[model samples]
Target chain A: MTHLPYIAAAYALAVLVPAAYGLAAMRRLRLARTRLAALDPRPARRETRRETRR
Target chain B: MTAETSAAPGGFEMAPRAAMFRSVDALSSLATPAPPKAPGRSLHRFANPGRFLRLAGALQPWLTAGGLILTAAGLVWGLVVAPADWQQGDAVRIMYVHVPAAWLASAGYLGLAVCSVLSLVWRHPLADLAAAEIGPVGAAFTGICLATGSLWGKPMWGAWWVWDARLTSVLVLFFLYLGHIALIRAFDDPTRGYRAGAILALVGVVNLPIIKFSVDWWNTLHQPATISLTGAPSMYLGMLWPLALTALGYTLVFAALVTARTRAAVMERRIRALLMAAAAREDGAVQVAA
Candidate 1:
C-alpha cells in the first residue's frame, strides 16, 4: 500500500527519538561522573557526607 | 602595640583587649561553621539527592529491562501477527507507534506539573531537578507524536497538515516543553531559574485538559479518544492489547530516562557545590597567609 512506508517511518521515528534521548542522558551522566571524580580525589569520602545527610 | 611594649604595662591591662578578641573569634567560628541546611520533609525519604540517587540507581536496570522487553514484544506482535484493517489496510499499523507517543506526551507534562508543585510548594530538593530533566524527554515525545501524527494524517486525512484543535494544542504543548527547558537554564542562579520554570510549568498546565478534550470541544477533523475512563474501549481486543503493551513499555522507558537524568543533575549540583566550597577554602587560606 502507498501508506505502508509512512507507517514504517512513523514507528522508526518514534523509537529513534526516545533512544537518542536515553543515550544522550547516559552520556551526560558519564561526563558528570568523570568531572565529579576529578574534582574530588577521594570520591568515596565526599559521597560519605552525602550518605550521612540521607 | 608590640608584644614587648604591651608587656611593659601590667598583663592585667590587656584583659579587655583579650576578651574582645575572644568574643570576635567565637562569633567568626559560629558564623563560618554553620551546618548545611536540612532538606524538607515533604517527600521525606526521597527529599535528599543522595537518597533519591540510590533509589533511582537501583530501579534503572529493572525499568530498562521491562521497557525493552515489552516494546519488543508489542512491536513484534503488532507488526507481524495482528491483521491489517479491511478498510485502511496496513496504514492502521501506525497507531501502534502514534498512540503511545501521544499518551506519553500528555502524561509526561502531567508529571512535569506535579514536580513543579512539589518544587514550589514543598521545596523538595529533587523536584526542580526532576522537572528540569522531564522537560526535554517530554518535548522529544511530543515532537514524535506530532511528527507521527502528521505521517498518519497524510495518508488518512489526505493532508499532511491541519490547524485542528487537537493538533494545535499539542503543538502548543510541545512549545511549552521547550519553553520550560529554556526557562530552567536561563539564569546564573539555578534556584532562580528553577523557580521561574516551576511557575511556567504550573501555568502551562491549563493547556493539558484542552489537549485532552480538544476533539470534543471543537468541530475538528481529529478523532475522539479511543481509550476513555468513563466508557468501554472502542478499539478491538487485537489492537488494544498491543497498544496497552507499548504504552506500558513507553512509560517504563520514560521512567528510566527521567530517573537517570535526575541522578545526573544531582551529581552536577554536587560537583558545583564542591567546587564552590573548595574555592572558598582556598580564599580563606590566602587570607590567613596575608
Candidate 2:
C-alpha cells in the first residue's frame, strides 16, 4: 500500500530510532556523578587521620 | 526475575492489567536483595556517594559510543538495505519504529518498579539514581511509541486515533511515566523524594498489565500477535529484518541513555555537595572576619 513516501518513512524511522536513544544517552551523561575522577583517596584519608592524632 | 517489578505486560499481547494487579496479591511485600557487602561498613562503599561518581564517569563514554554505533547502523540497515514488504508494502516498514517504541513503553515502567524495590529494600544510593534517570527516558519512549503509532495508524487503520482498549491503556502508561517523573522531584530531601517515587512506581506498576492485555481481553481495533505466534506476520520476511534492526538500535540506545543519565546523577550529587561546602566555607570566613 505504500510508495516512495513510505520508503522515506522507514528511513526516517531508522534515523529516529537511534536519535531517540542518543538523546536518552545525553540525558544520562548529565546525570553521571563520578567521585573517583576528582578525589585523591590517600590524601583525603591522611588528612582525616592527622586531625584525629591532634 | 525480580519479583517486585518484572518486565511486566501492560494490557499487551503478552500481559493483562488485571493479571499484573492480581499477581500483586501475593507479591505486594516483595523486595529486592541487599548489597553483598557488610550491613553497616562495607555497604558504605557503595553508598559512599564519591565511589559511585567515579564509576559513573568511567562508564558514560563507553555506553554512548556503543549506543551511537548500533543505533546508526540499525537505522542505516532498516532504511537503505532492508527490502520492502509484499503485502503491506512500504507501510509495513513502520513496524520498525512501532514495535520498539511499544516494547520500551512497557519496559520503562518495569525499570522504575525494580529501582523502587531496590531503593525501598536495600536503600542503595544508585537505586534512586536509576529511578530518577529512568523516568524521563521512559516517558520519552512512550511518547515516541504513541507518536509513531499515530503515523502508522493513519496509513493502516484509516484514522489517527481510536478509543481502543490498547490505546487507552498505553495512554495510561504514558501518564504513569509522567507521574513518576513529577513525583520524584516534588520533595526537597531527595531521599524522601526517592521514597515517594518508589511507592508511586510500585502503584503505577498496576497499569503495566492493563496495557499489555488490552488487545486480547477487550474488543480492540489494534492487530494481534506477531512473534510468540505461528505465521502471524501479515508482512513478508523482506521487511522483517529492517524492523528487527530498528528494534536492536532502539534497545542499544536505551542502554546508552541509561548509562549516561546514571552518570549525570552522580555528577549532580557532587555538584550539590561542592556548592554546599563552598557556601559553608564562605560562612565560616565571614564569621571569623566579624
RMSD in angstroms between candidate 2 and the native structure over all alpha carbons: 8.5
DockQ of 2: 0.26
**Native contacts kept (model 2):** 0.43
**lDDT tens digits, residue span B11-41, model 2:** 1233221222222111121122334453454
Clashes of each: 0, 38
lDDT of each: 0.75, 0.63
RMSD (Å) per prediction: 20.5, 8.5
Return the interface RMSD of model 1.
Answer: 1.8
RMSD of candidate 1 to true structure, Å? 20.5
Interface RMSD of 2: 5.3
DockQ scores for all the models shown? 0.56, 0.26
lDDT of 1 by residue, B1-290 (tens): 23432233233222322322222122122123233463443244455555555556656677778888888788776777777887778888888878878877877887788778777987776778888988998899899899999998898899888999999999999999999999999999989998999999999999988998999998899998776655556666687667666766777777778777887888899898999999999999999999
lDDT for B170 (candidate 2): 88
* Candidate 1 residue runs with Cα over 4 Å from true position: A41-54, B1-42
